[model samples]
Target: MAFVIEKPTLKDIAQMRALVSDEVKRGVILERSEEEMANAIRSYHIVRDGGEIVGFCALYVYSSSLGELRSLIVKESHRGRGIASALIESIKIEARDLGLEEVLVLTYRERLFQKLGFVIIDKTLLPNHKIWADCIKCKHFPICDEIALIAKI
Candidate 1:
């Protein structure tokens, strides 16, 4: 069956939250509340396979010129099916449509981002304070090892 990519809606909150929670448990992604996802539902893109949410991602616009890719997660059974890439492309299109000049991502999967045309950069180089606000929730806030990468659109 073909997967469908579309923006999330209120009804998707439970599934979205569960998917994120599962990822967090696996230590592969950060945790986000259902309320948070509901409020930011417009910024998310999800992949559904047979009506089940198998992949998810969000594009956070911090400024007119800057955006961040956050909470990219694909179901373990759905990896290697191009769902993640599809979600990333959807975010990139939204970023470009919003007139963003650059997009940043903090990810352990450097090679994946690199292959997608993202270049590694120093985390300190990002001057957005709001972006760092989320860092406080991270266990490794003071010593994050996730590589920061940017792709100019």
Candidate 2:
């Protein structure tokens, strides 16, 4: 099967929301409202298998020097097909094009990120703004179990 990775269109909002909502319910990702997804649509990359969205990822820039890789998910039927890896690669290219120095991720899939050249890092090393802006809103706030990782662009 051929999978195409590209920026999402406004028309993709509904499918994107549905996919994200599924992951959120499974506790695999945070819940993002439709408005939030629509507002930040430019930051996302999606993989389409024919007409269906099979995977999704987003890059949230913190500064010229840093970006956070967020909301990576692949449809369960498409797992192990390297769709997630391709989505991450797409995010990296976008980050490099934006002149970002590094990409960060707080992930439960440490080994997968590490395989893609991300290294484990102390979560405290991340910027304070990230903590205040997003982490604090996370349900796992004070006891976040997600491991932090970074990959230089």
Candidate 3:
């Protein structure tokens, strides 16, 4: 099957929220709301196969030179086909275009991200105020098992 990556639109918010919630329930990503997803829709990139969304990722810019990749998810049936990789690449390109020096994520898929050039990082060097703010509400906060990683843009 052929795949393409594109910026998600408002029309895709509900589908995106569904896909994301599925991943969260499966422990692949964090839970989120349609409002939050819609608010960030312009920063979200989705991977489509046969014109249906199969995967997605978002870049939330924290500073002029920094961004955090949030809520990356691939459909269960479509995993292992590089759809997630395409979504990530789309975010990386956006970071580059935005002149960001680095992008980071709190992810369970450390190996997958490492393969894509992200390296593990200590939370201290990251923007704690920004991440910690949202993380405070997370069920996994403080004791989050997710690995923190960053890739230079």
Candidate 4:
């Protein structure tokens, strides 16, 4: 199957919300508001097959030297078909093109990121002021178990 991966537009927000909301319900990801997704639509990339969205990811740039990969989700039926890998590669390319020095990710899927050249790192070693804003509101806040990984772009 072929998948087209590209930045999202306002019209794609609804489908993106549905995929994300499903992942939230499955407890595989955090909940995100459609309004917020739409507002940051430029940061998102999606995989579509025959005009149907099957996956989505976002690269959150904090500075020219720093970017974070977030909101990676693939439809249940489409998992393990390399959709996630493709999305990650796309973000890496975008990060490099934007002159980002590195890209970081906080995720439970440690092995997946590792296979993509990301190495486990001390979260504190990175400047993540913006991450804390979202972290504070997370249910797993103080005891967050997600692993932090970074890949030099």
Candidate 5:
């Protein structure tokens, strides 16, 4: 099957929320409320197989020079079909369009990001703003076990 990666619309919010919720339950990604998804809808890119949203990812810009790749999830049935890589590539283009210098991610899938040109970095090297704005709210917080990776855009 072919997949298209493109910006999501308001109508896509519910399906996007459902996808994230499934990953959240599996402890693979963070949970996001519908309102949160709606507010950041412009930041998201989704993979559609016909009319169904099978995968999605978001680029959360922190500053003109930095953005974080977040909430990347490909349905289990759709894994290994290059959807995730395509989504990341789409985000890289968006980051460049916004004049961002780099993109970062906190992930357990370090090898996957590495293949996409991201290098492992010490989590502490991340900005205090990121920590204060989002990390603090994460259940893991100061004890986060996710690996940090960065890629130049």
Candidate 6:
């Protein structure tokens, strides 16, 4: 099936929220309340596989200089189908359009991200709260064990 990627509408928030939160529960991504996702619908994107919302990603821009790739996930059945990679490229395009100099991710998928052009980095080098804002909510916060990775956009 051809997967179509685009920004999520307010109407798409509920299903999108379920997919994202499910990923969090699986430890593939971080937790986000549906309320929070609803509040930031414009920042999220969904990949429709012939009308099924099988994948989604979000780019939370901090400024012209930086952005964070948050809540990236693909339906489990669709894993290895390039679904996540496509969603990631979509976010990179968004960052480039905003003239962001850098985009970062806090993830355990080190090899996967590295193949996508992300480089491991000292978490300390991230922009202030760039890690903290979300990390603080993470159960692993303050003692976050996720690896920090960045890809200069």
User: How do the predictions measure up, each by TM-score?
Assistant: 0.93, 0.94, 0.91, 0.92, 0.94, 0.90
**Candidate 1 regions with alpha-carbon error over 4 angstroms:** 1-3, 128-131
Clashing pairs in 4: none
Give the TM-score ranking, best first: 2, 5, 1, 4, 3, 6
Q: lDDT of model 2 at residue 90?
A: 85
* Deviation of model 1 at 15, angstroms: 0.6
- C-alpha lDDT score of every prediction, in listed order: 0.85, 0.89, 0.83, 0.86, 0.89, 0.81
**What tens digits encode model 6's per-residue C-alpha lDDT throughout 1-153?**
355788777777777767677667766677777788887888887888776688887888887798889887787888998888888888888899889989899888888889889999998988886655776667666787788899998
Per-residue CA lDDT of model 1 for 1-153, tens digit only, reads 345689878999888878778668865677877777888989999998878998999999888899999999998899998888888888888999999999999999898888888999998887658446787677766687889999999
**Candidate 1 residue pairs in clash (backbone atoms < 3 Å):** none
Better of 2 and 5 by lDDT: 2
**Global fold similarity of model 6 (TM-score):** 0.90
Which is superior by TM-score, 1 or 5?
A: 5
Going through the candidates in the order shown, the clash numbers are 0, 0, 0, 0, 0, 0
How does candidate 3 score on lDDT? Answer: 0.83
Native-structure RMSD, model 1? 1.7
The window of 10 residues in a row where model 4 has the poorest summed lDDT is 22-31
Model 4 bad stretches (over 4 Å): none
Displacement of residue 127 (Cα, Å) in model 1 is 2.6
- lDDT of the structure predicted as candidate 6: 0.81
* lDDT-best of 1 and 5: 5
Quote the positional error of residue 68 for candidate 5 in Å: 0.7
What's the residue-level lDDT of 61 in candidate 2?
Answer: 94
Query: In model 1, which range of ten residues has the least summed lDDT?
Result: 127-136
2 versus 3: better TM-score goes to: 2
